[model samples]
Target: MNVQPPEAYATYKTYSAQLLAWDSSFSAFMSLKSHALTALQIRGAALLKIHHTTATIMGRCVPDPTDPRSIVTAANDPLIFSQSTNDFQTVVSLSQSLVAAAEQDIQRGNGRLAGGLTFSTDMGVVAPLYYVCIKCTDVPLREQAIELLGRCPRREGMWDSVLGVRMIREFWGMEEVHRQLRQGMVKLVLEDDGRWEWSWRDLHNGGEGGGVGYGVKEMLESQI
Candidate 1:
């Protein structure tokens, strides 16, 4: 339960460049790496409903003196469970470790460019943004995520605004919320394409983690 200095963010772009320049191919070595990546993904999703705090997760959870390897309930609050003896810290550390490993990919090198947020170079790239925002209470990490994204006009998409409206409608199943979504909210930001727009960062990233677009539907439909 002692605090240690956090590991420095490691994305050695230079070393990655060197590795790629080598003439001898490492395709045989890469097969194991590929398998590991797939395994990690399988393992990650195995944790049920990580978006909700009370959900049970599958990972290196807290060590209990009573039951060292037994399944223990981890509270939903990542900030609370992040204490040294809890599961949140272990999960966060493992996530950062993945980022460190992906930093070694010289080809494309997008993982390194993703600012220690992603492992593979794809849609999952934005996962680190969701992680630090939820797990760690570090302001710098959140800033780093936004900075790495850079500035873009209309950064958040129409999907989010509609989802927000849907959320309001779902909650309490109130007629007022339905009226607002139909009249106030939707009319406030209708574009030429007849779609509502949003400019907020999506904390619950359904697109990357969830199977469908933004996973808002899934989250809503979930028993949580």
Candidate 2:
């Protein structure tokens, strides 16, 4: 709470670099310690959604004095909880902490860059774009996310555009995509030729585990 003026900025810079480098390797670094990352994801998601939907979220949110330590402990340790007593402040500080922790892991160096958001690398590469998308609240962060998606590297047959679209759609109403997919007469599918095509499915049969492809059917079906 009483960080020296220079210490916060220095810390931010250090962590920012780490956040930029998170990749497939990240998962391994977190293999036995993934509860920390999971906590970050859950807390980050809640705070980002609140900010995105309302255009504002309290800079801090005081935990109920009676709130169970187990719940709060998942996201903010006692140290963080004591310092960031507001929603917005907590979100920002947590972002910094996550980045710092990730960078430290990478500095120790030992992972692979195969898949997922936390890919590892022998090199010091980073993926700040994803961090901004999931963290930061200002206009610049949104712009950065859009720009990064446009230029993100591809793997196998999957492209950043596909994942980018998913992220964008999430910012909008996720349920709306499902509703449209169900009611619409046509479903979109990717062809062997790498072309997108449409198919007809019965809406009545559409839903979780019901339609042809409705597992996380709500989100994935939108691509159709």
Candidate 3:
């Protein structure tokens, strides 16, 4: 059903230049994934795309001793797209390297990053509870964290993005963190001018950030 994957793989093998040309398109596609887009994922994809593109274009324009033209040539080959070829194997190795780097970057940022943590396994449903809290008592970090939450929740890999409702209840007892997060949400709403989607816009704009009618004002009242 998905012919794109094979085509992408082939593009990686022979005409690396062709693949390089598609870099912007590929990035746009990746961005549409939303919350699933991680800093590391973005970085790795950029690095991979640029490396391949540069190699292809340079190979045509000028020769370089440091570049691995063989790998680039193999990755951009057209035959590999029709059938799995040795070029795919080379691409696979490169992919593995990128994945490793991405993982390392995530760990460095998340501190105690657990690939994917789950609580219950009933019906194969794992609780969604992704978070992006910073250990700072300043406006910048807090504000940035709020913005991060607003954007990140729309992504794919995040638990909050996927299973926030189920996970929120689990953290009900942690008032301090919960309150801070609530404030962050409020900031998101105010910053967005309350004109976004009250239910999910992360702003007062009436997206998802408004809560179920009670609103941030009512939420604070009830909490206190």
Residue 138, candidate 2: alpha-carbon lDDT? 49
The TM-score of predicted model 1 comes to 0.24
Per-residue lDDT of model 2, residues 119-211, tens digit only: 233211122333334434444444544453443333222224446546764764443444555767446676565565444455677743245
Candidate 3, residues 1-224, lDDT tens digits: the string is 11234554444556655565676677677778746867656545644553453333333432233445565554344343324222223333343343355356456775223222222222111111122122122333333334333332233322343344334334443444446556554332322333422121244555534543333332221211
The TM-score that candidate 2 achieves is 0.25
Q: Candidate 1's error at 196, in angstroms?
A: 26
Kindly report which residue stretches of model 3 are placed more than 4 angstroms away from their true locations once superposed.
Answer: 1-17, 62-224
For all predicted structures, in order, the TM-scores are 0.24, 0.25, 0.21
Compare the candidates by lDDT and give the number of the best one. 2
Report the CA-based lDDT of candidate 2 relative to the real structure: 0.41
Task: Kindly report which residue stretches of model 1 are placed more than 4 angstroms away from their true locations once superposed.
Answer: 1-58, 61-73, 77-122, 150-224
Off by over 4 Å in 2: 1-127, 156-162, 172-224
Best by TM-score: 2
